[model samples]
Target: MLATPPDFDVLIVGAGISGIGMAAHLEMMCPNRSYGIVERRADIGGTWDLFKYPGIRSDSDMHTLGFVFEPWKHEKSIADGPAILDYLNRIADERGIRDHIRFGHKVVLADFRPDEARWHVTVELEDGERKLLTANFLYLGSGYYDYDDPYDAGFDFSEFEGQVIHPQFWPEDLDYTGKKVVVVGSGATAVTIVPSMAEKAAHVTMLQRTPTWMFSRPARDAIANFLRKILPEKVAYAITRFKNIRMQDFTFKTARDKPQKVKDALHKRISKTMGNDFDLKDFTPPYNPWEQRLCLVPDDDLFESIKAKKASVVTGHIDKFEAGGVRLKSGELLEANIIVTATGLSLAIAGKIDLRMAGEPVKFDERFYYKGVMFSNLPNLAVVFGYLNASWTLRADINSEFVCRVLNQMEANGSDLATPVLTPEAEAQLEEDDLFDFSSGYIQRGKHIMPKSATAYPWRLNQEYLYDRKVMRKGDILDGVLTFTKAGANAQSPDEQLEAAE
Candidate 1:
């Protein structure tokens, strides 16, 4: 008897930047391979759609963050949530990818059957109904963080009478005009909310336990705007993308190589922006820049708000929540009519889906990341995790392209499965390294759950884009590490096939 075939060649899990990019690549690269995207939410844009907070915008400029194939024609390189969503929507519509997506479907569990060389996925619909779908390959594009729950810092608000909010679940109808607001934390969200809320609020106070390193750049890229006017759209976008990628790489390298110099540069920039109001204690963090991602303040908005006395920063530990506001450990009380917890995100592995291999739960922390795309010993599965130091879409684009190549190679070679096989001998010889070196709260908290990494290439999820681009784009698929085989009784490892060929 013959085994059952999969419904689709590839089942992409998410409608976010990563999934959209993958679908676009498959359309161009592997046109014959049928695929479907199952988005948990009812909309197309993932993060952009979920986050409805005021002044929601892209931390990274759109040139590099935008898809490589798609040219971002927006005037502002650093665009807002709606603009980014529009860009993504346009891509889905123009490329005819929207027809392939099934919104309101959440992937709950996935089990790879080695015998059939297919993945049996269990999807839960929004109406609480469940259905089973099978696919030849599974691609997890459901971003890094938890969508259902943000990280809870365990602040007791029992004593406080004011409305407490988390930025992740911003209330759409809530009004803050003429109200005194307090935003907690010093991360990107807090910095963004502080300035944005200050614009309408009577006064905004940014309360943080520690200061985060911040750098301000114009919201609009003048060079990109200038180029768009003179040069062709594609050519101009390509140039700007190249420039931004190099600049991002250089800045990250400088921060790593010369910490003190980067620190001095950041201090000087912030000092100049804040002028006499700038205090060394409030702006200077104990750690170096890029250790934890630097907060990008567009057009000195945060500083301007502070200068205008519309917003203020308080550096202290929250002792407890009083009726009026948060009381500090330093015996100072910060008053507010509303409190916004700009606390960081909680990381989830494979979108918190129950991933199993041969009906057994797969332990991600025990597995190794292979070529930063797939995991060791995992067959026909690819994950889209972006760069930490650079724009996320950089990694997403490369990953999508690489996965398409793998699918194409499988077709050409008559192989049903491709797994990065790590034999016992090879695994024993490998040296383990921390998957991520950053000291950010979320990264550190979730380090134990992330896949393991080795010091060498192809065994680790690399942080450098320049090196990754060459290897992932041009490297051979049959590199001896990835074992390709057929299904059932005809199955044979790549080594055995090679021996037979010789």
Candidate 2:
């Protein structure tokens, strides 16, 4: 008797940018493959739908953040939450990707059974029903942070009588109109909320322990808008995407090579916006630029709000939370009727899903990252962890396309399993490198959960988007690092075996 085949050739987790990008690639590149997407939420947009906080917008430009297969037709490159959700929705519907999605189903655990060359997946439906499914390949696009929990900075809000809010779980019925609001933190979330809340709140104060590096740019992309009017949308998008990618790479490289130069440039620009006496200490960070992600203030909104006296900045360590507001260690009390904790996220590996290999739980920290796409020694599995310095979708697009190439090659060679196997000698000689060099609180706290990285190529995430794009797209698959095999067969490079036979 013959055995039953797996339900799908590819099982994708999450319906976000990365997941959708993977499915799209499979359709265009490997048309013969069967796939299914499992999203925990009922909606299509993942982060876009989850984050409904006021003035929530893209921190990066849309041209590079958007998928390569689709064009971001909107006038504003720094788009808001709803606009981005709409873009995702249109892409899903236009390509019939939505039809393949299994909404309201959450993947609880995935165990890859190497003997059968398939993954035995355990999923929970919306109604608390557990179902088992099998797939030939497992693709995880489930972002880096925990969806249910935000980072608890362990603030004492018990004594404060006013409403305290976390931006991640912002209530829809929240009413801060004409209320005195104090937003805590100086990261991207706090920077976004202070100016937005200042519009309606009687006064909004940004209370921070330390300052963050920030710069301003116009929300609308004038050049992209101009090109769209004359050229086809795909052509315009291609040109704009290329230009923005180059610009992003240039800025990051310049900041890393000449930190003082970048710092001076930022200081001069901020002084022009906020004036010389506006307290440079509030915007100056202790670390150099690109060490932590820079906060992008669109159209100088945050500075303008501060200049208009609608909002203010207070930098000090919080001693405790009082009835009125937070009391600083400097013995000063900031008054507020509403306190917003725009603290950072609580990071997780592989969406906090339980990953295993043949019943043995996978300790991600022990494994090395392989080409930023798959984990070393893990077969038939791939993940979409995007670039930290550049746009997330840039790496997502490249990773999705690369995975498809691997799948197509596997089929051509009649191989059911593919793993990036490092020899014992290679592993011993590998130099350990930090997976992410970010000093942000979340990255620092979550470093223990991330996979190990090496100093060499194909063994690290390499945060350099341009270099990764070139190598990932055009590099040889049979690099001898990735070994392919049929079930119950000896592992070897398929091309090598073919040459030996010839």
> Each model's RMSD to truth, in Å?
1.7, 2.0
User: Residue-wise lDDT of candidate 2 within 1-502, one digit each (tens)?
Assistant: 0198999999999999899999899999999999999999998878888998899989999999999989999999998889999999998998999999999989999999977889999999999999998999999999989999999999888899999999999999999999999999999889999999999999999998889989888999999999999999999999999999998888888999999999998888888998888779988889999899999999999999989999999989999999998899999999989999988999889988899998999999989999999989899999988888889999999999999989988899877888898777888999989889889999999998999999998888789888888889999988888877777534365445434433
Q: Once superposed on the true structure, which residue ranges of model 2 sit more than 4 Å away at CA?
A: 490-502
- What's each prediction's TM-score? 0.97, 0.97
Q: Candidate 1 — what's its lDDT? A: 0.91
Q: What global local distance difference test value does model 2 have? A: 0.90
Clashes of each: 0, 0
- Residue 249, candidate 2: C-alpha displacement in angstroms: 0.9
For model 1, the superposed segments whose C-alpha errors exceed 4 Å read 1-4, 490-502
Tell me the whole-model lDDT of each prediction, alpha carbons only: 0.91, 0.90
Error of 1 at 17 (Å): 0.5
Which candidate gets the maximum lDDT versus the true structure?
1
lDDT of 2 at 193: 91
Q: Write the per-residue lDDT of candidate 1 for residues 73-164, one digit (tens) a residue.
A: 99888899999999999999999999999998999999998778899999999889999999989999999999999999999999999999
